[model samples]
Target: MTSTPISKISSGVSRRNFLRTGAIGGFLLATGSATAMLTGCAKSVPASDRLFLREQDVVVLTALIPIVLADALPTGEARAAAVTRTLAAIDGFVGNTSPAVMDQLYQLFDLLSLPPARVAAAGLWSDWPNASEKDLLAFLTRWQHSSVGLFRAGYAGLVKIITAGWYLLPESWPAIGYVAPVRVV
Candidate 1:
């Protein structure tokens, strides 16, 4: 697995400090829940529709999948198919997590769903559907290098989720020269 380098900040806002202040919870309450209510996305979706990720989360991942996968991602019509499959894998991964972890993931997704928060936190002014590759890259780069520990944590979580989701798929194994172990009789 490839590791992302994070630079330390000289500021007083450490990860512990960020969590202790409940800023993320505040963001979720103020923006995420409000946006969800306004957009009617707070309603529970049917079981068959989605496991964990909401429709808005899908939009965010759809934009991010290609950029994160890069050369490993297939091109042409297959590109869309690959992304779809990877999303399913991601859903499965998220679905199996504990409820607390799931809630945290949802908070992150919801935060990104808000336009104002998306712009301020990710530097993504446009919706995920309309964001260019350059814009996406810049956002990822900024988060990776951000002085704020929370931003760095989010960056790490996102990259780990995306990469893990993609690599967990059997179809993606061949690309990285991974072959499942043979069973012993």
Candidate 2:
């Protein structure tokens, strides 16, 4: 009986290490493609509409606002109106932000707009429009609790923007019991 050398057969890499390496590699690859896609998509936004966010950014925000403000947003036509108002608020807020902040927001939105980046960063495999409320909630929860600073920052930013937008609306004032100050003529 010929005895095979154990050392020669073993690659010495543990399964955990292999998986970690693979995950990192996949993340890097996805980010690279997403960056390339964002660069190519820069011109896709119409000149008239290209203020702070592109069309894709709007789509992302539309899909996410409900998830972020689940309890706050009403159902039926009220919900539709609220969403529209919130989107306009977000657009205005973005427009008013400094150039540096806007650039960072653009980068974040660009990543969220990409499929691979969305899956890798948010654990969301379904397209935003197709994603269930449960799926969206889970993704938000994960990012909110994530140890990664970038993920935490993203969670904070989304929540802040969505909540601020919703609360700033006059329609929301009644619900929140905020009486507007009277203007002095």
> Residue 75 error for model 2, in Å?
1.9
What is the C-alpha RMSD, rounded to one decimal, of candidate 2?
Answer: 8.5
Q: Model 2 scores what on Cα lDDT?
A: 0.76
**lDDT of candidate 1 over 100-130, digit per residue (tens):** 8877677677677778778867889899999
Per-residue alpha-carbon lDDT of model 2 for 1-185, expressed as tens digits? 98855544576555565567567645644574567466685333522554566787888888999888887888988897889789888877877889788766766776677777778777889988888889999988988986555677878988888888888888788887889999899
Clashes per model (N, Cα, C within 3 A): 0, 0
Stretches of candidate 1 above 4 Å error?
Answer: 1-30, 33-47, 183-185
Off by over 4 Å in 2: 1-34, 37-39, 42-50
In candidate 2, position 29 carries an lDDT of: 48
RMSD of each: 7.2, 8.5
Model 2: pairs clashing at backbone N, Cα or C within 3 Å: none
Best by TM-score: 1
Worst 10 residues of 1 by lDDT: 3-12
